[model samples]
Target: MNVEYKRKFTAVVTALALVGIGVVLLGRDRVNAAGSGSITGTVKLTGTPPHMRGIDMSKDPYCVKQHENNPAKMENVVVSSDGGLQNVVLYISEGLSAGEVSAVPSEEPTVDQHNCMYSPHVVAMDVSQKFKVTTSDQTTHNIHPLPAPGSGNIGWNKSQPPGAPPIETNWKAPEAISVKCNIHPWMHGWQVVVKGPYAVTDEKGNFTIKNIPPGSYTVTAWQEEYGTQTAKVTVAAGQPGKADFTFKAK
Candidate 1:
């Protein structure tokens, strides 16, 4: 029975090896959150808010009905009552090591088409991170992502009819890709693809990028309309770093 024992021993060794590999991958996605730090801050919009362009959804009866209570308008610069900004993307721009930059999140971000408008006006993603596009409206929509020429991102335009399956995909490079719908000319959004951990500002202009290792970093905030702003901060283990920013409405 010596040969039978040897075979069983080999099988156990192989199984252990596979488990080790699995742990490594799991660690990358979870990043040992217990030992990691986070960056938190608020983004404010100073000065008077710009007059957003009104959207004419008369072309689609379904779209028009969806916004009967509240009219549609351009989301280029949406500000809260307290002057907080919405849809601002924040990410670790400098001081991240190669390993951190390559730590693509396992979580998937989704952009939904609702009421003939993009639910969230801006989406931030890490390079190679998979995201989804979904349609919630009754009308058909053609998603057109326009990345700059030679930016290493191939652009694609696809149509999604009502109740269509979600379109899942990922980007290979970092760039601010503009997303539009051919069917709805007033529809506009953005995919700010970057490297490393990122966060998007909420309606109150608050954000927090989690799972960052304790260290000093240069944080960058990007607003589609007013450009970008940067700041330096230090994160401590189990504690959070803070960096607040304000942009004038030009």
Candidate 2:
């Protein structure tokens, strides 16, 4: 082959080899970057359940059938520090690098007050993100949030006449916020204002948060009625770790 032609062919081969090596290095990086762990466990209530207060079964026609003559009395509905669960807010306390709070935030979460009860009594949302507190009853409802110290409560006293638009509004804060409806007196709820992603346990009292970078972390669990429980967890790359918290009734 001509000398120039041979030189061109060598250059092409060298370039292709470099690209292939680059691709291989990138694949290795992706493998190492798969260093993520998970947190999972059952949050159980460990004490005698509290009594149902604040709801009137006689007033709202829907209460008796929907909640079945007092949901506050159900075992699954109780918030116990010792009995093992309710309003469980399990989340990473800190240390892992985190992104800024979403600008404009995601869709607002819904907290509904109906028939003198806060549906999904325990709520959680990212800090500074917008969320909606709504009412379905025709009565006057006042939303009172017990915000963190130095953080004033966000209260809304909007009359919700029957068949009227829901008494709704948005709240954005950086700490766990307790909520209540003063009109019903028995209606109560909680908002766990986490700094980042978090989840509340389901009826089975189980929760799992995935894709956390390997490291030591403080996992906190909070219930409106049962108060809070916390545990320390160490995560290794590609492993699932457990941190269970149990609380007793006072």
Candidate 3:
């Protein structure tokens, strides 16, 4: 009788322990689900895109050879055959709380130099978020960023030779910083830094800005050539809000 009672008590304790753990896990899942939201949209061009002039890489034979198969062209106004606008930076221009404004992304964005052109043509990042500048060319290139004065974001220019290490850094303020390679005059790109969550439009103009808390925000979409457009959106917990924008070609 005594042995049987002890066995019963042990079984009961084991079951209770399992139940307690299950409850904790369920609470954690619920808290995570309630914490954040997302915003999704597409950016399109309404009118016909102006003809982008072909880049002349004759000054650097290495750059010319890199683009021998597929010639390089200006990316000032890249529009897909379906009117999808690429290289546009969309961010929360307003309506962010103090906590949200301080939340910077951990993932690093990259601006790669391939075939004497900046891949993606434009890079968007949150303020104080680290980004990398890498090169895939055999020739030496300079990384020069021209930030506007009094913007609190100082300017820097560094030389990146063949097989050199990546230049890792972050911006201090929100601005569209223009980047260029002095060696290759045709090389041009933009590093758009803004506060809070942001996303860059893909080739199809699709974008999704994640980790946004529940609130109404003023979202802005900026294209290097067409300028900026803003829209208002409201996000709910665990739900994705939608806002699309169209930039008319001038």
Q: Pick the candidate with the highest TM-score.
A: 3
Q: lDDT score, residue 51, model 2?
A: 63
lDDT of 3 by residue, 37-111 (tens): 889999999887999999889999998898889888899988888988888999988888888788888999999
Tens-digit lDDT string for candidate 1 (122-236) = 9889999999999988899999999999999999999999999999999999999999998888999999999999999999999999878888999999999899999999997
Over 4 Å off, model 2: 1-37, 51-84, 98-107, 138-140, 146-149, 152-154, 163-172
Question: How displaced is residue 61 in candidate 2, in Å?
Answer: 6.5
Deviation (Å) of 21 in candidate 1:
23
With candidate 1 superimposed using the best TM-score fit, by how many Å does residue 20's alpha carbon deviate from the native? 20
The candidates, ranked best first by lDDT, are 1, 3, 2
Q: List residue ranges in candidate 3 displaced over 4 A.
A: 1-30, 34-36
Q: Rank the candidates by TM-score, best first.
A: 3, 1, 2
Residue 141's C-alpha lDDT in candidate 3? 93
Worst 10 residues of 1 by lDDT: 27-36
Candidate maximizing lDDT: 1
**Tens-digit per-residue lDDT, 109-165, candidate 2:** 777776667777777877666777666765556677766666644644555545556
List candidate 1 stretches off by more than 4 Å: 1-35
Q: Per-candidate RMSD vs. true structure?
A: 7.4, 4.5, 3.8
